[model samples]
Target: MPDHLSPDPLHILHEVFGYDQFRGPQQAIIEHVTAGGDALVLMPTGGGKSLCYQIPAIARQRAGYGVSIVVSPLIALMHDQVGALHEAGVEAAFLNSTLSFDEAADVERRLARGQITMLYAAPERLTTPRFLSLLDGLLSRGQLALFAIDEAHCVSQWGHDFRPEYRGLTVLHERYPGVPRIALTATADALTRTDIVERLQLEEAGRFVSSFDRPNIRYAIVEKKDVTTQLLRFIEAEHAGDAGVVYCQSRKRVEELAATLAGAGINALPYHAGLDAKLRQQHQDRFLREEGIVMVATIAFGMGIDKPDVRFVAHVDMPKNIEGYYQETGRAGRDGEPADAWMAYGLQDVVNQARMIDESPAGDEFKQVMRGKLDALLALAEATDCRRVRLLGYFGEHAVPCGNCDNCLHPPELWDGTETARKLLSTIYWIKKQNGIGFGAGHIMDIVRGKKTDKVAQYRHDTLSTFGLCAESSEAQLRGVLRQLIATGALHVDAAAFNTLQLTDGSRAVLKGEVPVRLRASVSAPAARKPRAGRREAKAASPAAATLDAAGLGRFAALKAWRAEVAREHNLPAYVIFHDATLAAIAERAPQSLDDLQGVSGLGVKKLEAYGADVVRVCRGPHG
Candidate 1:
């Protein structure tokens, strides 16, 4: 057996995972779970959540416990995780619908003979009678180690990616009374966390809540203007020749955007539910195994992606809620490298989202909850304060200015818009009085800008006192102000009225001058052409790349080349071989031998034996 197979969590961490120390609550969670204690872990994505359960499972196995059964929702995630574990010289297998009956039987045989240390299965499969019978046999022989429920937030109906099958997971606890259970989720609010505990029947589990902050990712939200142009500019400026995910609101938009990127010479592919299963799998596989491929997709593309080096996640349209946005953006910078969460939103996004909620067949209570969530996201986008602070605050946490997001980098000046807000509110009220109906932003903006269009003339609203009150402001500026007002609760979009703008009860305060409305100043438009300074400009512009020097960059490039070659040989993602963080550490340290290489983080005994010499040679270079 390998040294990591020792009956010690610390040994497993060092020898199998090649880390010198645990991060955040990893050690405590691991120790608790290994001691037969149930745990509910709410760590952010890329925060080492996997180690909390993986280390414990390995330790339990070494302590004469049976194979750890991990319940996962995604077959791709299981496959990627199992591949990484095998590279670390650990025995792991997955049982999912993707496996043929004979292949699944072989895995079952291995589990029965104590050949596998960890087994991953989809929740639907785990709850089946045949699988339950297998588990019963294992339990009868005392071969069950523990149970781990991943993506535990799926148990909550209110969560972004609720899966009904997750509710049936309590069967594990009921069937195997003594087996410890640990539920893990990358994105969960307080409500979702409670739901996980209740649904998984892990009320007694220890709660390990980490901060929901991804400081490595820079958050940026820009007003949508020529969306394709903006998106192309962002890609060309910062993320050219890098792996990323671009999220769109609809399948048609995803397809269109993917084609646009491809026409611009970007290696982009579209993914959605509309695609054939084989095509989707092939695209996902290429994204994983190849470098610098961008996946243009809707929300369906990112739930189970384990790729860690994605440099950016761009949203061509707004998400319905903050949780969905956070989860999608969390897919980037998983390796602790600098990544970007860039979004382009406009007033239309809000109207479209409101329309979606109102048109849904869900109950009134669910609609209200969803509306509240969408409003919170809108507030975040329109916030003049720190974006990180506002975002974390929504999740019941507090944070100071991160200084990496757009808000912090270029602090928006607060312009008192009390008069502007009053004018807009009076217009909405007056329009209702005249026609007993609300008007969307376009007509309202036209009246405000004194455009005197056909609708304005037909309504004869040119006679209204509030019409053209703010002719000094441009259409874009007025739209920005209105978005902020809506976000601040001074105005609301009446979903039932075709998303017409309406004044809320709180609008009285602003109209009466009792409240001061401070809105973010409009950002100046960019120059027609941006300067081209090559990769150096890209690296220097990113906060995440501040750590690299010229020599380090050379070594990093060499290490990446080696990783790519190895990944090709194994038909695995480059990150699955070794994350960029590990490569950067190797480049910085320039390890000369196997002993020195062991000191680098993420280089376990298995990795050191397999690639230590090649890594050292790459570090030394030809001159050395």
Candidate 2:
């Protein structure tokens, strides 16, 4: 029945989940929740937030609270989490639409009789009257243990992934007053945090805000030239044959890039809401089960995924806010291995995101808030100091310069682009004034650079005093300057007029020399990226670089093969069976017996009992 055989949380931790000690605030959070205290935990993506709730579910169940109800947002997440819990020998089940009528009935019957230890359901289902009635029955019987809200930021309007359905979750606190509830999230700013607490009525809950820094994931944002070719080089040169995810802005881009990557001999797949539901599921399944599969997707695919081996997350376009970027990039390196968060950004990306916000039929206040968020992201991208510092600082946390980001590796030289920026803006103003209409960025750039192209000749713009005043500036450098000008509100994109440039009141400052415009000297050169980091990182060149001896490598490879077979037989992702780090440790030591495997980090009693002998057999080579 997956019952907890001990009263101690540490004992349960070792025996059930197989970890030696708690990390950061895990021990305190677990103890608080098990003793019937509510908590709001804000941890990074790979920071062991699951253990905070999962361990309490086990401990409270053992202490006679009966069953824990977990509120999850996605079915895929619930399925994978329940599958992993079952592997750890915890009695967990999820009741969603995936179950047939009889299957749901059976699960309900079991729940009514208190046969399940933990139950997972979406917020919509959890708040439904039918489900509440069942919960009432359990409440009357004193069977309800705890209520865990995962991704609690969805309750906030200011959050990146807000959902109106989450506002209905206040019912959990109102209905189950005494039941200890834990709200958990991976990304939440101070504003979103307050919203979550107020909306979920967790004001009295203990707040555990861990450091938001992810040291294992290096950050990089390159100026875009050929985005696909740049992405191809990134994947091939450093992360070839590694599992990655490339995020695009549109469904068509996702489809096209997936095909392009496949043609380049990379195993890639397309996943977006536009595809058929069945096909989307198939693509997601392939991405989960297979190694070295890159998923080209939009924001639709990456909320509650639990895959721990993703090597990189690339963005071909920029998102509207820092919160969204942080959430999407957090998907990589959940195993605490070295990974990357790479993006190809440019002036057009800024324009697209700004245009999206400007054209939306939203309130003025809402648009203002969105622009504020977008400006923060632009600052991070254009940062000359440290990307990590800029990112961590946005969430109201302070961090020193991380020597792992692109800026730290290759310091950018900022040039006084005031003369250049003024020239470009003046050219745009003159042309629009003469023609009583606006032109796109291309015409403006050509005129400022003295291109003497047919259009420039047709407009006779070469005769203007501002034309070719900054002919020495490269197009790339000018684009960087222009992007900064727009980002700083000195320029505006006339989305209603085919995305032509227009001057705002703020532009007058730059033109009158009241503001200075500085930009990176060489913006679009992707060849300048060099690898470096300040922290000691796991060698990501292979599965187990620490075990590079021929025998250890062979043993690790064989263990992985065995794990793949077991995962296929069980119909789960290979990491769900065991993490790569766990298997690598086992291979490095070449455990001689079952007792030798007892203290490995992820090897719980249940896992040892289930797969201990087979792991030993695989370690002893073919004839063992």
Cα lDDT, all candidates: 0.86, 0.89
Model 1: per-residue lDDT, tens digit, 14-80? Answer: 9998998999999999999999999999889989998999999989888888889999898888989
TM-score of each: 0.92, 0.95
**Candidate 2 lDDT (Cα, whole model)?**
0.89
lDDT of model number 1? 0.86
Task: Please provide, for model 2 over 1-624, each residue's C-alpha lDDT reduced to its tens digit, 9 standing for 90 to 100.
Answer: 344577478988999888889999999999999999999999999999999999998888888888999999999999999999999999899999999999999999999988898999999998899999999999999999999999999999889999889999999889889999999999998888999999999989999999999998889898899999989988987788889999999999999999999999999999999999999999999999988889999999999888888889999999879999999999998878778999989989998998898898989988888899999999988888889989999998899988878888778878898988888889888988898889888888888888899999998888988888778878888888889998899999888998999999999999998899877776455345554432223433344345456688788889989999999998899989998778888888898799889798889999999999999999999788
Number of the top-ranking candidate, with TM-score as the measure: 2
Q: What stretches of model 2 exceed 4 Å from their correct place?
A: 1-4, 432-436, 452-463, 526-545
Cα lDDT for residue 156, model 1?
A: 91
TM-score of 1: 0.92
